[model samples]
Target: MSSSIDSQTAAQLQEILVGADDAVEFLSGLAGMAAAAVSEAAGDTIECAITLKLHRRPVTAAGSSARAIELDHVEQALGDGPCIMALREMSTVLVVDVSLDARWPLYMQKLLDVNIHSTLGVPLEISGGAGAALNFFATRPDAFSPDVYEKAEAFAAAASNTLQLSVRLRTVQGRADDLEAALESRTAINLACGVIMAQNRCSQEEAMAILTKVSGNRNRKLRDVAKELIEQLSGSPVRTHFDT
Candidate 1:
């Protein structure tokens, strides 16, 4: 991916960033920006889409137009497109005329069916995040010139950087949530073991063993079993010393 955008696009991108750039839904704006950028650089651009691979699945996170999003779904379902090849090749792939493009025959046919004759896919740099690409579609054959393609590449790079930051933000937030959940699970299990220890007058190891058996017998997760034990004993009058 190119590292920097031209001054004009940089200014426009900055405007987009300043306008309601939410972490999770930011891709929609970025995809729109990509299509608008290419359109501004060269006319005849019909649609644009941004694809982000999550858990090894391609999702059309955002699009400049509905048709762009539809084409993305078609590519995902069939597992073929210039966009997929761009990501796989880690480079730009262009289908000058869908009817004449023989590399991805099925994908080309679908494009023709949609009245999208030309397509350009630019690989993006997600930076330790999901694989991504920016795709543009045109109704006319060879609608995008080499210069326009280069300009769109710069926009793709910008989208990549912004997307990477958003993805990393989500990752950090997810890790924090996971840590909190793990801590809660640990506390629950420890409390359950302590309760078992008091009731059975057994060692901590023996209490854990008993808990494990209950978990297995009930076909439940250890944490679920632990939580149930604590809940069950909470309102009991003859409760053990698990209040600590």
Candidate 2:
């Protein structure tokens, strides 16, 4: 590993990252690229972790590979760790001297257990809220240099912009899902209301009241009651009702 990357290489990397189209793909690429660049520049091996938050919580590690899943498990099991702190504080936190830092005793112990000595964490900015964190780890003490910090901060800024775009994408996707679900529910409820109107010769309000009463009596969701009504109207098997 070399202790420096030529300015040309750094410029090329920046250009590629800026020109990338997909936010998630860009962030993923930047993580690996930045880690490699820094490791080469520092003449040491490094490990990095990027955690993205969704719906105000860190998503489960279901879709990740073993190493990532293990990291997520560590954070969950430890109850307090660098990732949690980074997410909470919304700033970079460097544990250059983890052995001397006494702020998080339990977390530091877990880090030591895992043989993680030095760490640097930077928050991934999310518009409208606190976002995610990208953390880098080194086995050796005092692995980060002043130049490393400067370049790492610049890379982190680019990564943060991509992460913010991801947040927006997720929000839009969530809204789309919500709208689709609402549409389906409204369609089912309307069908059920129409069945009631025809069968009981009642007005829309009366049908809704009847469904509400049935829902309360059965301790069931309104959607369930409405679905049952629609199923009956469509000649499906009707569920038997009983007194609570």
Candidate 3:
């Protein structure tokens, strides 16, 4: 297959990235699209699953269907399979016939039990110490011919940049959420401290010390204790501008 992505598939991948609400949704869409692409190329039904790893640990998995998801999970649970191997080796791993592939005995048995006889695992290039792969499953032996393999590899290559963008967006969103939560917690704690100072006729530092003591005695997080105190005093839940 050519290294360059065809225009239509590239547009579809771009659409998946732009329209997805989060990383999970984006991965699911990507899996479905990958399945469709390979199926179209091979003229057979193929299921796809995507596995993502960060720091050499599995971060998430998505599938084109429920069965695809289950198969991927089985591989993860067993800790060995073509997909896992592909991610680890950063190369394509193909099992032309699951029954005959003795490399992953347990995984082959599991796939045979599910009536899936062939599989292809193609790694996606991603930066930031992140790794990803597209896993394709078929119901017949040697379903992934050379042409099909080439097509799948091409699709994975084309989708790599989009996957990287999705991951970066998710990381940014997570950091923003953490920062927002910290700000809200600080606001609640300050308000709670003010209430304590007024009620006890104490200094701000004294109020903070009292609050900390109460938090430790209750064995609860400082933020939780602060929020509860404010809620009890106001007879309503605390609401920050970030709420809703």
Q: Please name the candidate that would achieve the greatest TM-score relative to the true structure.
A: 3
Ten contiguous residues minimizing lDDT sum, candidate 2 = 59-68
TM-score for each prediction?
0.77, 0.65, 0.80
CA lDDT of each candidate? Answer: 0.79, 0.66, 0.90
Q: What are the per-residue Cα lDDT tens digits for candidate 1 across 1-244?
A: 3334456555566566556547434667777878877887776665788777777777777788889999998898888788988877789998888888788788888888878989998988876647998888999898888878877887777666666666676688799778777777887899999999999999999999999999999999998889788878885322233333
Model 2 C-alpha lDDT per residue in residues 182-242, reported as the tens digit of each score = 7666777777888888989999999899888999999998878897777866776333322
Q: Which stretches of candidate 1 lie over 4 Å from their true place?
A: 1-24, 54-59, 99-102, 235-244
Q: How does model 3 fare in lDDT?
A: 0.90
Candidate 1, after superposition: displacement of residue 158 in Å?
A: 1.2
Identify the superior model by TM-score, candidate 2 or candidate 3: 3
Write model 3 residue lDDT over 69-172, tens digit each, in one string.
99999998888799999999999999999988889899999999999999999999998788999989999999999999989988997899787777787788
Error of 1 at 66 (Å): 2.0
Name the candidate that leads on lDDT.
3
Q: Model 3: residues >4 Å from true position, as ranges?
A: 1-7, 18-24, 54-60, 97-102, 109-117, 127-129, 241-244
Count the clashes in each prediction. 0, 0, 0
